[model samples]
Target: MAQFKPGERVEVSSNDRGFRGSWYAGTVVRREAKNTNRYVVEYDQLYEDGSGEKLLQETLDWIQLRPPPPPPEKKKVQFKFGDEVEAFYSDGWWEGAITGEHSGGKFAVFLQRL
Candidate 1:
């Protein structure tokens, strides 16, 4: 009965049994106009059965936004030879380990991290 915006996280209400026992945490992927407004959400939660691992395009009305949890404590990681870390690149976040070094010591390219 509430409006959901694209990319907003939402949970499937308990009454929505179609997706009740499966993955519920999802992001609103699209909105549709059926007799009533419907949302096509991309389910992000993993289910025990591997068969249900596809992006679920579920209706919007059945989903409700779950309040975001508090942010986790920030842990600063010192780059080391085999330390796993994520590198911020122009494209996106790349998971890797410290492999090579650069001039200032602050820059290092992760190798075989993912």
Candidate 2:
């Protein structure tokens, strides 16, 4: 049987009707056991068109789990003079070059180019 946890995103296999290759995206809300080898999953559908629907508690032997993307790498503060660095500004993080530095190694970076 497929193992699914609450709050996990899942893709429901296409319906037996003529539903084509489309799959429904939903969050697993409940699970029930039938007999000794089958599982019934209850899912809440989240649609792109701002509509939601609840499945009638379907049973399945397996479910696919899609992992979330990795987080971005953190920027290090160590930089030498004239080294390119991305500066956080009012607009957003902008690429810039370190123009000067203090005696304690604090850098004064200027936006060399957009």
Candidate 3:
């Protein structure tokens, strides 16, 4: 029995050793006729040519697919404009200042070190 059904949005593993932790967005098409543990997926952005207009579809093992993550929860706003904050970027925390606030708990920060 497959955990996912047709038309469900999922993230497929890259399966490349160089990018082992990456996943690409795709939609489940159907389970393989001869293999229930495998599925056909249509990738969201992959293209068959350099024109970047066609989507690429491929068969993938169930172990390489996972349901998309849920939307992030909104956090209470704690800092106002001009407040100094530290943001994580490039594998390190960098000093920054909150410059603007956007909808959905997003903030526009200006990092002086960048």
Candidate 4:
């Protein structure tokens, strides 16, 4: 069984009839009092209503839980000024050109909306 500490974030595997193979984000609240292999987890987004007003908490076995994957590493792509690129705007990706370069692999992109 995997060991998880309290307050640690983890993903809980679904054991529901139709939701098998799904994993939900949650935090480990504590281990079960009588069962060392079980833990009490507070889900991040699992709710009891359609409005998501009530959060769901449950005791899950350690076998049904796993640590969340590590964050993705940032990659730097060199681009020259005036190089054409696609920038993600408020809601969607838009075509743009690199106007300037900044520290930490950041770039100033100018998107001209038609």
Candidate 5:
């Protein structure tokens, strides 16, 4: 029997030597015990927003699979100088471009209005 079971989340190790250290998180859609290292996996598209997509489905070696890393802690967005963004203030949301970075994650922006 395969170590990984159906519906398990796993990380696929890169097969290319040039990207030897890269890994991608995916869900085990199906698992096969007919031979060693066999499973079907579904993952999120590169541009999709957190939605899972089945991009690959083939029996692969078990050595290419591993547990995925913990989900990253939610972090505040940090805007850099010259980045176009919206800023909230006492009035409301304002369209602007970041002028400078402050000590905190705050940024100074030149508002289009006011």
Candidate 6:
């Protein structure tokens, strides 16, 4: 496992009694010492989204930290033209029909433009 860096997103243990379960998510605000595992995390309320208020900001060891999950993988588009697909778009996800395969994960989608 790589050393957690400041601004690195991670999950923090909420188990105050040192129980095996329970975790609260937060970002690594700062490193205590150079090349050390100490961190200061500003914790949020359990299950709180960005809109919710923060609960606690505390110093914890690296053992209490867990890396944030990897981003979701894009599904491979397997099409032979004229295939309907709900393709991801910059504006928003769109349901479009595949018109051509441009190779190497590229495809021409005839999107039903809004």
**Best of the candidates, TM-score:** 3
TM-score list, all predictions: 0.40, 0.35, 0.63, 0.61, 0.48, 0.48
Runs in model 2 deviating more than 4 A are 35-57, 61-114
lDDT for model 2 comes to 0.52
Write candidate 6's Cα lDDT for 1-114 as tens digits.
447877888877544543334456678888887747778887644433455564467888888888865676797635778887656554223557888888687889876653
lDDT (tens digit, per residue) of candidate 2 on 40-62: 44544432343445355565445
Q: Between 4 and 6, whose lDDT is larger? A: 4
- Once model 4 is optimally superposed onto the true structure by TM-score, how far is the C-alpha of residue 50 displaced, in angstroms? 2.9
lDDT of 5 by residue, 81-107 (tens): 899875654323345789988885777
Q: Which one wins by TM-score: 2 or 4? A: 4
Q: Decide which is better by TM-score, 1 or 6.
A: 6
TM-score of 6: 0.48
Choose 2 or 6, whichever is better by lDDT. 6
For candidate 1, the clash count comes to: 2
User: What count of clashes does model 4 give?
Assistant: 0
Residue-level lDDT tens digits of model 3 in 1-114: 447899999988656654444567789999888989999999887767779788889998999888877775797558799998756543233457899999988888876641
lDDT per prediction? 0.55, 0.52, 0.77, 0.79, 0.64, 0.67
Query: How does model 4 score by TM-score?
Result: 0.61
Superpose all Cα atoms of candidate 6 onto the true structure and report the RMSD in Å to 1 decimal. Answer: 12.8
Shift in Å, residue 36, candidate 3:
0.7
* lDDT (Cα) of model 4: 0.79
lDDT of 4 at 88: 53
Residue 34's lDDT in candidate 2: 55
